[model samples]
Target: MKAKKSLVALAVLGTLSGASYAQSSVTLYGIVDAGLLYTSNVKTAEGGKALLQLASGNLNGSRWGLLGSEDLGGGLKAIFRLENGFNVNNGTLGQGNRLFGRQAYVGLASNTYGTFTMGRQYNALQDYVATLQLVSALTQFSTHPYDNDDLNNTYRTDNTVKYATPKLAGFQAEALYGFSNSTNFANNRAYSLGANYSNGSFNLGAGYARSQSPGAIGGAIVGNPSSATPSNPLLDAARVDQWGVAGTYVLGSLTLGLLYSGSLYTNSTFTLAAPRGTIHFQNYEGSVRYQVSPTLMLVLGETYTTVHQSGESGHYLQTSAGADYYLSKRTDLYLNAFYQKASSNLQANIDGAGGAASGSSQAVVVAGIRHKF
Candidate 1:
């Protein structure tokens, strides 16, 4: 009788363990991308020079992440994700050498309600409008001049709380707030809102974001590095505002896309030698994608950007093209090229190519492979 009782207890424990395991799950995923890049013009102290080098994260940033979910019953679940970005070329961490720089968030999700998460995460423009822009989806070098609108996701917000609404009638919305986490509550704070509507083959999205005293604190929406001078041009701004709208439509084997975005910075200093003033940028983009076959796709995009600062204005015109071929569901090869021209004493600087051009025009080409697991 004693033996039988022990066996029954062990069976009960096993049953409980199995049930618990069924209610929780964790997944590991990653992407690795590398490329051979060539630039027609890169500025030097003396003159422009052509460059050829190996680069990483051409189509997508190389990253790995862990995602977990626990079913808590009553149509609610606990979810968490930790994502890290790295440079495959030199095996160094990206995003200022911080671990899990891409995203680190945990919160509750409900089927009827929505999701609430807290941690380092992207803002509204990256979540909504960026998805609708073909350039953002295709390659990093295609972003609007210096990624002024954050559509290319140049930065993520830290100490952030985000809420996303459940899809209702083909519409979804989200909002986020990033606290400064300092004695001064308003310093380095940020907020954003985004919404999207998807109906059949057509989609539209809009988003807005703002930050106060960006780069004021290490844990703020835009963190400051240990170095005395910041690397990014917009880091030392007193205030930053960004807004955008985008739309996409699928017609047979072709898809059409359009995007418009604006960024404004107040009391910002670009460099140690530069003066503090207000700077504004406006971007307009259009793109088209054609599916040649089940595994081959072609894309073309163009952008016009205007900048105004200190009673002077400049403009940039950029054109980009790409072809992608899928070797398998998890692997692909791509060739992309870009050309940019600047006016009014502005220097052409294609995103992710390297430095600014010595002249008013620059061009770049990249061939790459991407794999996902």
Candidate 2:
């Protein structure tokens, strides 16, 4: 009788353990990317000079993270993700040196409803519109001039609340709001809204974002307005508004995409002339990707941008092309090249280089490898 009781107790405990294991799970994942880069016409006081160096995150930022979820029954779950960004070359943190600068969010997800999250996160523009666009979807080198549209996710919002709707009838929608946490309302605040639709082989998306006093010192937004970082130019403005539309069509092994965006900086300090009023930028882009084989792919993209500021207008044209070869499911090699030209008094910023420009042209080439685990 004691043996029988012991066997029953062991079975009960094993059942409970299996249930507990099934109710929760955690995963760790990461990507590492690094490359050698060469740039032509790096601006300097004396003259434009070439640059050669080791680069990190040529196609995607290096990152590692933990994602976990606990089943809460009734089709609901508690979820959290903590992601970190770092430089592969220097083995240093990337996003403001914060351990989880890339993303840190926790929320509840309902299979019947949707998801609600709060923390540092990407705006809706990045989640919906930008990801579908070719310039932002392709290699990092393909971003619009200076990433003026924020399509490359130049900055992320902190202290944010976000809601994402479950896909219904091939449609999905999401929104985000970032608080300033200041006495003066609207100071350093940001908001975004976006939606996407997918049907058959066509996908379309659009989004809008606005920020007040973005990059203001000691404000909700962090960074120095005058400092030039690899991913951020830190252009200060009283108010900024941006909107974009993007679409992609897939056919067999080829995909084509189109993107358009407009950004307006009001009462800006980054303008060329004094008495700063507003600086406007409009971008148009197109891109194509072809899978030559199961393991090889080719991509090409182009963007044309117009800048309007203080009765002056400038034109910029940027082109990017690349080839990617996959050695394994989690590892790949790539070669990407980009060229940008400016006309009509436009300062040649050239893909966030923040250099001195002798002329209106800049070019860069990057060869790299990426691994995911």
**Best candidate according to TM-score:** 1
TM-score, per-candidate, Cα-based: 0.93, 0.91
In angstroms, give how far residue 240 of model 1 lies from its true place. 0.1
What stretches of model 1 exceed 4 Å from their correct place?
Answer: 1-16, 223-231, 271-276
Count clashes in each candidate, considering only residues at least 3 apart in sequence or on different chains: 0, 1
Q: lDDT tens string, model 2, 1-373?
A: 9999999999899779968665877899999998898888887776889988888887888999999998888999999999999999889998778899889999999987999999889887888887887644446767777677788877788889999998999999998998888887678888999999999999999999988887654444563556443224434777888899999999999999988999988867665423456888899988899999999999999889998887778888988889999999999999888888888476565664335357888888889899999
lDDT of 1 by residue, 1-373 (tens): 9999999999899779969674887899999999999998799987999999999999999999999998998889999999999999999998868799899999999999999999999898899999889665578899888888988877888899999999999999999999989889999899999999999999999999999988786545653544542435675688999999999999999999999999988877763112557889899999999999999999999999998887778899999999999999999999999999999478898987988888899999999999999
Task: Estimate the overall C-alpha local distance difference test score of candidate 1.
Answer: 0.88
The candidate scoring highest on lDDT is 1
RMSD to the hidden true structure, all candidates: 4.6, 4.6
For model 2, the stretches where C-alpha displacement exceeds 4 angstroms are 1-18, 135-137, 218-220, 226-234, 272-275, 353-356
Worst 10 residues of 2 by lDDT: 226-235
